[model samples]
Target: MLRELPRIFVNIAGYRDTELPWTIKDLFEKARHPERVFAGICRQYAPGEDDDAAPDGVFAEQCRVYDVHAKDSLGVCWARHQTQKLWRGEEYAFQIDSHMRFVVDWDEVLLDMLGECDSARPVLTTYPVPYTPPDKLDSPVLPVMFARFFDNDDIVSFGSRISLPEDAPEKPQPSAFVAAGFLFGPSKLIADVPYDPRIYFQGEETNLAVRLWTHGWDFFTPNKVVCYHDFSKRPERPRHWEDKVDWRRLNTVSKTRLHHLLGMEKNGDPEALKGIENFGLGARRTLAEYEAFSGIDYKRRLINGKPGRIADLPAGSPERKADRKRRFTFIKESNGWGCEETASGGGSTMAQTEAIRRDLPGVFDSLNIRILGDAGCGDLNWISHITGGLQAYLGFDIVDSLINEAREKFYDRRNHFFSQVDIVIDALPECDAIICRDCLTHLDHQEILPALKLFKESGSRYLFATTHFLGKNTEIKTGGWFPIDLTAAPFNLPKPLITISEEAPNSTKSLGAWKISDLL
Candidate 1:
């Protein structure tokens, strides 16, 4: 009894490339088990002009082709989506451009590298080393994705740079972005996160990376070079945008669909985005979790190299756990939290804070709370409008700048005070009730208990904090984001004495009031 070799489904989207034939030849010639390698091509070419694009002999027999007129082609992603439809229940999915050269035993190399990843669902992807025409490949250096710039359409575009030999990790390194040209992962990725045919071109990689991550697929770049992409072919090749007349209209609609899917466009017309629900983000994780893991903030159009959360490390590895704690400590030493003047983030926006704004004052009066403490008050955005009746209002935040600005802005109001405090370890002031909104969700699991203990040690009788009624509580790195349910297992907090709905559009978020002792 012998074990069978895994089947690999190779997806190539050819848009009038003359190199397609040679690419197929190289693919078959370099694989150790050629019989297990299956190619699926979406060939977009003019009727009589691209006879060479078709596979010949053994290549033809092993491949499945879907032909389309080059003029009718939507875009690369559209063609890739069509190519995915030809999959025949293979074990792995390997996607690459039509013009590529391969290393010897590249299929086996990729499978071996993927096996080294710590995650159960690992996706290996990167921009391949570039090659010139015929047979010339550039120096064999790994290319890793980086946030290049924000395009005019407000979507983040990624660029790649050679990983320095001294800096590149020995194993596959955790990656935050995906390369559309080269991606290799399990066949389950095809079923769980299929490419959106509606996306035209620009937002394809970001869209795929986000959806794959949210669906519980971890990404890593290969430690060894497996293939070379023809970078010089683009100038000579015929692109879909050049051949199609309505390319602009198609691109616009595609970008809008991407924006809505990423939650960047909260006010977009629902009628214009009819079928986007079928291609939205996954339920295993939230968009906010992706933003925290990757430092690319979609809403703010900002890319900070400082990562908030580290990827999941293996459990019971004491050194790795210590390193994780050190990485989180580095964040606090480098800088305090950031907040915008009008809105801090999704949690603190005016729209999401409306319900709490309308109900907090009445609740304060009912509790007979004259002295109030605001734990983790960020920039005093909407909270300033609700503090009219308090005899004294004290605001605390980790960021010194926000605290200083708050003091200067309300200098005329004698009863208002601001101070910088670290809620996890610092001593807290005595107040009737402590309002800790939009704070606990950002702390690491280990830190949350200490923060709760600190709050309990404070003389405050009542605690009002943000809690999500929907979804199970998930852990994140120190500066990350997630909808934390206080009543869940880890916290085991009792039901709130009173709940004020935040009216969040995506989830059931509310300001839940609890006794400080119940939080621990």
Candidate 2:
């Protein structure tokens, strides 16, 4: 049985009957998880007017609701409720907007995540918003959305879209930062770092995050965990309110204040505080005050440590540029055709050329010949058509009526002929060399393994083939095969003696080749 750990205490603020998508009663009915204990502090506009009915109906006698509202007592009431919850020794606490929905098994996710960290460390989690992108508006209501900005517990950087680094491993890593809407941490941590009442709304998270980061708290976001927020469900307001309040300005102010408190601003120069200013109000003030308090001159620091601009740094620094260079070399070596218009297309053509080129030197030196698939409309067969004097044979699979008619009318049966194409282990011919270009990608995954096995058993001394490497979100085309595995192996049998080239081509006809033997 899974261990029943400490329960999660959720503090939902600003939740009202009309503001919620459905009544809070309906929301909790779906959230009736046995492991979690629910408690709500609903503020009422009038005294002795109990709003406890909502929690009573939703929790079904499982939780408690307190009506702590009085005249001008909103902030104090929330503070008191938070204090009381902490006093009760709740293990984990979250302050959330009422409209957010829980999609995943939070208990299992949190348990698995927390187990990966030290017990002494703090826990902070953010929900993924599912409805941010306009394109998704037409789709079914998804439970998660992609965040465009980068988030860290200490600092929130907006505007830039997130992407994996070029050198990133196959799997994604934990993010260094995250937003606060769905923040999480140990109950004691929250108790120790109480929200500063001075912050009405804007800079509260910024201030808290700066303090946490300064104190050496490790912060991260799980790559896969997600949640959805109902941004559209917020209370309606009067027109021109956006211009009057200038929420963006408020954000700038809070960010500036937090930066100031964290001592991030050292000098009067604005560049040091640019990120904050760009974010909005609290940011500028925070940096200004932080500079004043820390007595760290920003101008002096800037002069002492001049960070290089991104453009000035060597291309793709922090990762060796060799991989890209290797890819280019392979392209130039492989592609013999030069007709393509773009560098990438040209490179691809060259890569194909190089694959044949590598084997050419050995074959020419030995005065031996090789055979490739027949010269049909398929581009690869052109090699056999062009090399008139070379001892190369063309093998055609003319099953289609149109192709058979074209073949019969075109008068070239002397050099090329249709043959039975079989991929089983027993049907292939023993040869000194063979080539199968751009054919693997058309086979099914099931056919690939067996075909490779048969190729190995063909007794061919050398074989060459072109296959694809898997990329993100790539799908198999209808009636086409996706590669089973890209790695060279006994699975990719009858492996060629010569190096396979995978490079960008320059054109339709000229594939450059570099002998790996030359590198030796």
Top candidate when judged by lDDT against the true structure: 1
Model 1 residue 274 lDDT score: 66
| lDDT of candidates 1 onward, in order | 0.80, 0.40
User: Which 10 consecutive positions of candidate 2 have the poorest summed lDDT?
Assistant: 144-153
Q: Candidate 1 lDDT, tens digit per residue, 68-88?
A: 989878899889999999999
**TM-score of candidate 2 on Cα atoms, chains taken together:** 0.39
> What's the TM-score of every candidate structure?
0.58, 0.39
Candidate 1, residue 487: how far the Cα is off, in Å: 64
Cα lDDT tens digits for candidate 2, 320-381: 12322222232322331233532223323544456555555555445354443331223333
Q: Ten consecutive residues with minimal summed lDDT in candidate 1?
A: 307-316
